[model samples]
Target: MLQTLHRVTILGPRLSFGSRPFSVSSILRANRAVVYTQTGDPSQVLTTVTYDALPSPAPDTLNIRFLLAPINPADINVVQGVYPAKPSLTSLVEGHEVFVGGNEGLAEVVQVGTGVSGLTSGDWVVMTKAQAGTWASSRNVRPQDVLRLPRADGLTEVHGATMTVNPPTAYNMLNDFVTLEKDEWVMQNGANSAVGQAVIQIAASRGLKTLNLVRQRPDLDDLTRKLKALGATKVLTYDDLADRALTKTIVKDWTAGKGIRLGLNCVSGKDTTAMARLLGDDAYLVSYGAMSKEPLSLPTSLFIFKNLTTAGFWQSRWYKTHTREDKENLMRTLVDLVSQGKLKEPEHEILSIGAEESDEAAGQKIRDIITKMSAGQYGKKVLLRFEGAQ
Candidate 1:
C-alpha cells in the first residue's frame, strides 16, 4: 500500500515515500537492499536482493535514506569473507530475514526515532561507524551511529558524502601519531589514492611537506601537475627509485637534507623497502594498506641503527576505541575542512537505490565494475549510489 502525508517544514518540496511520515509500521516508499548470505567465489554471484517497505522508524534510531556508498577494495574483501570485521544481519525487512553487506555510506535523515535528541528530519548525516548501506533507500539506525553534517556552504553534497573515509585515514596518520615539523618532509607511496590526495591537501594546509610516489601512468605529466597543484612537495614514479641510493637522494633533497622523519607505505615488500630506508634516526614508518600483495619485509638495520618504529591503523578499530568526544572531534574537523573549500573530492554520478530493484542488468554491471579495479587505474573512488534516500 502507498500512502502520503503532508507535514509543514521547509526541507524543500517533497512528494516522498517510505520514511518521512511518522506512524506505527506505516509502510512508506523505501529502498530494499540486496545482500550475500554466504561467501562468493570468483565465478558465483552468491547474493540475494530484497525490496520491501521500510519498517517504522526505530526508537532511538534515525531513519536514513542512503545517498552514495563508495566501493573500496576492503568492501570486496568483506563480501568474500576475507575481511576481519563483519556487519551483522541487523536489518529487518518485516517478513523475511537475511544478512546485508555494506560498510560506509552517505545519507539523509527523513525522520527521528523516539527519544532522539541530537538530530531531526532533513539533515544530512553519515554513518558514525562502518556498515552503512549507502546503497539502500532507507535505514533506521541508532542515533549514535549517525554523524550530523552542517550545511557546508561551499561543498557539494556529493563531496560531503564521499569525505568520511580516505580523508580521515590520511589526516589521522599525520595528526595522531607524530608531531610534523613545519616544512619538514614525509614520504608516502600510493600518492594517487583519494586518501593520498587528501594527505596532500591537509599536509599543505599545515605547511608540512610530502614526497608522493605512484606507479608510472600514460598521463604521468598531467597527474604530476595535479598533485603539485594540491601542494605535493614532489611527485615521482617507481621507475625513478629502482636504485635505493637514488631514492635516498630524492627523499633527502625533498626534506631539505634533514632526512625524512617518517615514511608511509601502502604497498608492501620492496616498495616498502624504498620508503623505509629514508627515515632519519628515531623516525617512524606506518603502513595501512597492502596494494602490492606482498608482506612488509624490513631489514634489521633500519629498526636498530636508524631507530625507525613501525605500526598500522584501521579506522574501524580506532572508532570503537576512542571516547565519543574524540570521534565527534575528528568528524567536525573533516567537515570544517569541507566547509572552508580546502578539501576537494571528485563529483559523483548518483546510483539511486530504486535502480537496484527494477534493473538487474544495471546492478550487475556496477558489481562487475567494482570487482575489477585492482588491475586498472581509476581517477577517483567509485561511489555506488542508492536511491530514494532521505
Candidate 2:
C-alpha cells in the first residue's frame, strides 16, 4: 500500500522585467534540485542545490515544474557510472559544474514560451526520452523534448511520474516481439517486477495469458495470489521451473499443444536456460535485463532444434528510433488502461522534500531511499515530491 502526499504550492510575487512595464509575470521562483557533478555512488556524489529564482521560459522553451520523480534502479546505475546514457555537466551552478540526477518524472507546464504550441500552463507532461534531468523543482525545456499527458485520463501523479519507463517497456516488448494472439501464452521471469506486473495486466487486456516465474519466498502463496489477481495465468517459483517433470507438465498444459512462442527474460543464468527450453519452434526470446548478474548460458540444442531467436530490448534505444507521435499514442494507450481499471498501479512510497527543509535534509532523504533500493530492502517503488510550488 502507498500513502498519498498532500501538495503545497508556494506562489511568488508578480513582476515585470522586460522593456514593457505593463508586462505582468511571476518572477523569482525558488528552486531545489538533486544533482551530481561526477558519476559515482549516489550517496557520495549526489548534492542538493538551491536556486532563489528560476528564469522564465525562453522563446522556444517551457518552464516545467516537476510534480514527482521516481528513483528507479537504472537511475542509481547512471549515477554510479555504470549506465550507458550520461547527463551533460553544466557550469550554471556558479562556482562549479553539476549534472542533474534523474531520468523519468511527471511535470506541469508552469510557463510556456510565446512560440510554443499545443501546450499551455497547467498542462501535464513527461520527458519523451531519458537523461532529461527531472529531479528538480522546475526546468526550462523545449516542447519536443516532452509528451503531453491527459489529466482527465484518470492516472495519479505517482503513475504519471513513472509512465516513461517500465510500463512502456512492457507494452513495447509485447507488441514489438512475436505477434501473440488471444489466449496465446508469453512466459517471463521477474513476474513480481513492475514491468512484469504491467505485462500481465496488458496481456490480460488483450486476451493473452502469461506464465510468471519468481524466486522462492516465505510469502510465496500470497505473492502467487496477488499476481494471479493481476491476471497471471500461472505464478511459479524458480524452483518450480527447475523441476524437469513439473516444468514439462505446466508448459504442456498451459500451451495446449502449442509451446510458449514468446519468452521475456530479466533473470539470466539457469533461469534463462529453463525459459529457452520451453520455447516452441521458431519462438523468440527477448532479454531486456540481467537481474541475476550472471551471463546467459544457452544450450546448443535450443537453437539447433527449437530454432529459438534470441534478441535484446532497450526502451531508451526504442525511443531514439521512434517518432514523437508514436510515443504519444503509446502513452495514451497505457494511461487509458489505468483509466478503464484494466491495469493497476504498482506499490510505491513517496519521499516529500518541503521548502522549509535544508538542502542537506533533501539529499540525506534521497540517499537513504537509494541505499535501501540498492540493497533490495524496499518492496514499493520510491517517488520524490517537492514542496513549496506547484
Candidate 3:
C-alpha cells in the first residue's frame, strides 16, 4: 500500500507575460509519482507518493502535466535492475528518496517560464532525455529536455507517448544498416511487436516488402490478417520456419531467387538462426532485442561463405550520440508519416488512475497490470493516464 499527503490550496497573485496571464498558485497543484526505493520486481517495489504541490519552475524551465505514459519492456528491465541505464535517485517525496519509473510519455506545458522562448502553455511535447521520470502527474523540465510535437492536431495521445521508442527503432534499423531498394525483400521475427508493426507500415510506404514472422498463437489467422492490413507482405508463424525445405521453398518463391538481403531480429536463438539462413550474400542481420532470453548463435559457415554481417542497435544510444537537429529531423519525418496516414497508432489499452482514488488503490492497480504484463497476458500496449495530471 502507498501513502497520500493532505492537499493544500493557496491563492496568490497572478503574473503577466505579454498577453498571457500565468497564476503561480494555480500551477502549484498536488502531484503523485510512481516511485521505487530499490530496484527489483516492479510489482513488489513500486508505490505511489503524493506530494502537496510542486514549486514554480525556475528560469528557462516549464511546468508540464503528463497526458500519457507507456509501460515498455525496457522500463520493466530498468525496474528489475537488469538494464544498463539507471535512473537518477531523487528526493522529490520530502524526506524519502526514490527513483521514478517511466522512460517515455506525452505531456502538455501548463506554465511557461520567464526565460523560455518559442514554446507557450498548451504545447504538446515528448521527453528527449532518457529516464526523465515520466510516471508522475506533473513535473518541471527545461526546453532542451523535451521536443515539441510539430503536429499534434490529428495524432492521439498514444501516438505522442509512443513516438520516441519503437517507431524510431523500426525506422532506423531499416534505413541505417542497408541501402534497400524499392521492391526489395526484408525478413524479421517478432513481427507483431510495436517496432515490427512500424517496420511493416514504413516498408510498405517506401515500396519495400517485409517477411514478418511471429510466435504461433491461437489467433494466428486473426494476427496474420491484422499484419497484412498494415502492409506486411507476408506473415507466418515460427513453426513454419522449422521445416527447412518449406522455408527455402517459400523464400525462393517470394524473392524469385534474389534472396533476402536484410533481416530484423528481436527474438534471438534457434529461430533467429533459422531466419538468418535465408539471407543472401553480403546480407545484414540487425538484432535490437533478445526477447527469448537466448543467446544468438549463428553458423560461421554463413559468414565465411556468404559474407553475412551481424550487428546490434539500441535507440537510446542513438539519441545520446546524435545532435538535437538530427533528432528533430527524425521526429518531423515520423510526424509527417502519421499525418499522411502512412503510419497508424499502435493498438493499446489505457489504465487510468482517477483523481480521487486512494494512493494504495492506484499502486495496487498498477501492480496488477504489471503482473499481467509480466505473465505475457497483454498482447497490446498498456498506457498510463493519471486523472490528477490536470
Candidate 4:
C-alpha cells in the first residue's frame, strides 16, 4: 500500500498483457518524461514531453511507471560529459521524442511478463540493470533486470528513491575496510554530508567511534551539534586538524586497548593527509569522492610506519559487477532504518515536470536544478517528479 504523497495518485490492479480485457480509456495513458537528444550542453539539448501510449507489452518484460527520481551529483557529472558510464540513447515515444534522464527512480509495476510471477504489475520495484531508464512514465524492461523490491512496509517513495546511493556508499565503505574492535576509532572528513552522516550512524550502531572532520561554516556549532547527535565521538575543524598534536588527541581518546583500525577519506586535499597521519599501523583508508579536487598526496612515512591500505569505491560500478543478494539485503536494511527514523536524506523540493515544455526548456530545467545543488548551499535533496504520476 505504498501511496503518493501530497498528490492525486491513481492506483489499480495489475493489467494483463495477453488477452487483456481492459477498456482503452480506463487504462492510464501517456506518461510524461524528461529526456535529451544530444550530448554536451545538456540544457540546450534535453527536453521534457508526454507520450499518448505505452510500449507494446512483451512476455519477458516488466512495465514500470516511475513515481519519483533524484538528481544526484553523478547524474550532473554524466550529463556534463564527465562520468565513465553513459545512459542509453533510444526513445520509443512518438512526436517530440525524448530519452530518459535519470539513473534512479521509485516505480510500480504496471504490467509483468506472463513468465514473471515473482513480481506482479502492482508491486513496487527498483531497476536491477545498471542503466535502466527510470526518468520516465512507464518503460518496458526485461524481467531479470528488475529487483522485486522487498516489502517497503513503511518506507516512503522519497526514502526508496534516494536511500540507495548515499546509504549504500556509506555502508560498503564501513564494511569493506579493516575490521574494528569495540570502542576503536575511525577517522573521516565531510562530516556534514549525507553519506558522512550515514557513516556516523551506521558506525555508531556497530559500536565503532568516528573522529569526524568538517570545514568551518558560519553556523559551525550547529553542524557540530548535529554530528554529535548522530553519534560522532569528536568533531574537529580543518584549522584544528592542521595541528600536529591532533593525531595524538585521537590516539589518546580511543581505548588504547583497541586502537584506531581505519580512516575514511572523502575530502581529499589537506584533510586526507591529516587523516592519513592519524591512522595507526595496519590501518585501511578508503576514498569515494574528490570534493576538494586535489590529488591525494601522502607522505612515505604513512606506508613505512603506519602500513596503511588505501582504496576507492564507485557504487555504480561496484554494484554492476556484484551480486543482487547483497544489494537486496542492503536495501532492505536501509529501508528499515529509514522507516524507523534512523536514516534520511535532506528533502529539498519536489519538481512537477510540465507536459509541454520545449526540448530546450526541459534541458535548461534540469541544468538549473543540478547547478543549484552543486552550489552547496541547499542542504536538501532535489527530487524530479511527473506532474501526472504523482
Candidate 5:
C-alpha cells in the first residue's frame, strides 16, 4: 500500500494528512510574498515573507494565484514612498504588518466563494484596482476588483500581466489628446521604452505615423531597426536632434511638409524641448513621465505662436474617474489588439524565485534587480515569478 503523504508550509510547521488524500485546498496553503515594513530605498527596505496559505475566499470573492508580475518603475517609486498613490498595510503575515509591492500582475483563479458569478477555478484575470498587492503566491480578491480575459489564443501571461499600465497609457495618450488622420505624423521621445513601443504598434494599426526618438546607445543601429520593424516611421537618437535646423528639415521632409501635430514626452528637459520644436501649430504635447528627473521647459514662442498645449496623464487617475464598464471595455479593446497581432508584448526578462529558495535569498535577488534598475542597467523590463512549494 502507498504511504500517506504530508504537506509543509513555507514558514510554518508541517501539516500531516494521515491516510487521507490531499485536497486541492490543502495543497495550496503555502505562500511567499515580497513586502516592506517602511518606505525607503527598495533595496534596503524590501524583504520576502512566507506565510501559511491564505484563508478561503469570503463571499463574493475569489482566490487568485499570481503567474507573473512586472516590476514597473512606478512600483519602485511607490515602494520608496515617492509616488503619490500608496498601498494599504496588511497584517497578512503572522507577526508583522507590511505593505506588498506590486501594482500589476496576471493571476489564475484557484477557488471561488459563494455569490461569486462568472469567475470559476482556472480562469485568468488581472486586477482592475491599482496596488492590489500582486507580488505574491496567492491571495483573495473581490470579483469586482478584477477583469477576466477571454482566454483567447496568443494571450500570454506577459501580455495580461503588463496590459494594464503601458499599453493603455499609450492607447489613451494617442486617442485622448489629439485626432490624427491616416498617415498623419506623431513625434515622441523615449520611443524605446515599453510604452513607446506600444505607441509605435498602436499608431501603426491606426495608419498614423510615429517619429520615434530615444537616447543614444551603443546599439543605436540595431535599436532603430527593431523600432522600424515594429512600424515606427523613423527612429533617431537624441544626438540626431542636436542640429536643430537639420532635424527640422528632415522631419519636414518625412512628414511631406504637413508637420507633426502631436508630441509625446516621457523624458523631460532639453531633449523634450528639442522634440517640441518639431510640432506644428495647435499641436498637443502630453507628458506622461519624467524619466530624466528634469523639468519640462518649452519655448514661450511655441505656446503663443505655435499654439502648443502641454498636459499630463496618469493611468491611476484614469481608473479612479472611470466606471467599471469603461475599464472593462478598454481592457477588452487592448486584448483584442494583442490577439490580432496589432500589438506585441514588451521586451522583458523573467526573474523567477524557485520553490526551494529561502525567503532571504529571494528577497536579495529582488533587491539586486531593483538596484540594477535604479542604476539604469536593465534595458528590458523585469518580471517576477515566485514558484510555490509542491
Candidate 6:
C-alpha cells in the first residue's frame, strides 16, 4: 500500500487512501541532481536528474539538503572511474540507480527521524566518510554517515564545505607522522596547493615553521607574498630545490643548526627525492599526493645513513581506521582554530546554482568548470553553492 502510494504520488497527484489523507512528503520540484551511472569523461557521462518530491527521513536516517560542495581533483577522478573507492550504485532513489559525483560537502538537516539523537533540523553536518553521494539537492543518510558540525554561525559556506578534507589531512599528517617540538621545521612541496596552504596555517598555529616549495610560475613573487601572508616561514620554487647554493643558504639561515624533522611531499617524482634530502636524521617523509603523476626516486643513502623514513598518508584510509569519536575530536580542534581566526581559509571561486535552474544548464556549467580545471586554467579552488549563500 505504501509502495503504491509512493508510485501514485511520483506519477501524478496525491491521493487519499483510507483514513490517512495522502500527500507527498517533503519532496519538491526544486530537487535536482547530477549523476553518472557508467563512468567515463564526466562531461559525457554526467546527467542532470530531478525528482518531483523529496522523501521524509527513514527511521534511522536524516533528510539532508546540500548547501555547498567543492571541485576536488579526487572528485574528478571518482567520476572517471579511476578512484580507489567507488560509490555503490543502487536504485534507491526514484528508481534511478547511479553514483553521485562529490566526495566532500556541507549539508543541512531538513528533517530528522525518531532514532536520531544529538542532531536536529537546521543543524549543519558534513560527510564523515567517502561516497556519501553529496552532489545532489537532497539525500537521506544515516546518522553514522555524517558528523554534526558545531554551528553555522561564524562559518562561511566555503570554509564549512572545504574544511573536512584538506584541513584535516594537513592536521593529521603534521601530528600523526612525526613528533615535532615547538619551533621545529618541516618542508613540503606543493606549497601553493590547498593542503599546502592549510599546512602552513596549522603549523604556524602550533608554533612550527614550514619550508614551502612550489612550482615556478611567472607570478612567483606574488605567490610567495600570498603564502608568506598565510604564515609560510620560507617559500621557494622547485628550481631552487636542486641548487647547492640555495640549499646552503637555506641551511645557514633557516635551519640554524636544527634539522627539519618532518618532510611533506605531494608532487612525488624528483620533487619527492628533493624534499627527502632535506629531512633531519631519523626523520619522517610523508607522501600524501602524487599530483605530478610521476614515479618517486629515492636515494639509497638517505635510508641507510640518514635513517630517513618514507610513509604515505590518505584521509580516506585514516577515516576507515579511526573511530567516529576520533574524527569528531580532530574536527572539533580544527574548527576551533578556524573559529579563533588562527587559520585562514583557502581562496575559492563560488559557482552559484539556483534551485530552479534547468538540468542542462546546471550540467553544462559544471562541465565548463571541470574543463577549466582539466586544462589547469582554474587558478582558485572551485566551490558550488546550491543557493545564493556564497
Taking the tens digit of each residue's C-alpha lDDT, what string does model 2 give over 54-84? 5788898989999999988999999999998
Tens-digit lDDT string for candidate 1 (1-390): 433332221122111123333332332243445454455541243232435556668777767777667767777777677788776765454443444556777777887878999788888887767765444556778888877777766766667677667787888999876788898887889988877888888898888888898999899999999899888989988777788887777677666679677777788778777667767887878888898889899899988798888989877878788877787788788878877777876534454444324334434655666556544545556776654322
Q: Report the poorest 10 consecutive residues by lDDT, candidate 3.
A: 9-18
Clashing residue pairs found in predicted model 4: 109-121
Clashes per prediction?
11, 1, 0, 1, 1, 2
**Between candidates 1 and 5, which one is better according to lDDT?**
5
Candidate 4 residues 1-390, lDDT tens each?
221111111122111111224333322333656555545555444455445457556777767888788877777666666778788766455432334667877788887767776788678887766556677777778777767666645677777676667888888888877767677788888877878888898888788889888898799999888889888988888777677786566556564645566777788987788778777778888888879999998998888887877899878876787787877887788777766666655545787565444333544676677667767655767788765442
Give me candidate 5's TM-score against the actual structure. Answer: 0.91
- In terms of lDDT, the poorest run of 10 residues in model 5 is 9-18
Q: Which stretches of candidate 1 lie over 4 Å from their true place?
A: 1-30, 46-50, 347-349, 352-359, 374-377, 388-390
Sort order, TM-score high to low: 3, 5, 2, 6, 1, 4
**Local accuracy by lDDT, each model:** 0.69, 0.83, 0.86, 0.70, 0.86, 0.79
* Better model by TM-score: candidate 1 vs candidate 3: 3
Cα error of candidate 6 at position 111, Å: 0.5
- lDDT per residue for candidate 6 within 1-390, as digits (tens), equals 221122211121111112223233322235666677677787777655555445677798888888888888888888888889788774444554667778889899999988999899988899987877777778888899899887534677678888789999999999997888898998999989899999999999999989999998889999999999999999878788788667856765778968787999899998678777777789998888898999888999989998988899999999999998998898789888888887776798888776556456777888888977978898798887665211
Stretches of candidate 2 off by over 4 Å are 1-29
TM-score of each: 0.87, 0.91, 0.92, 0.85, 0.91, 0.90
Candidate 4, position 292, lDDT = 93
Give one digit per residue, the lDDT tens place, for model 3 in 1-390: 333343322112111111223244332344778888778888888876566466778889999999999998889889899999899887776665678899999999989888899788898899999999999988888899899888745687889999999999999999999999999999999999999999999999999999999999789999999999999999877898889898899889989999789999999999999999989999999999999999999999999999999999999999999998999999998998898898899999999887666566778899899988989999889998887544
Query: Model 3 scores what on Cα lDDT?
Result: 0.86
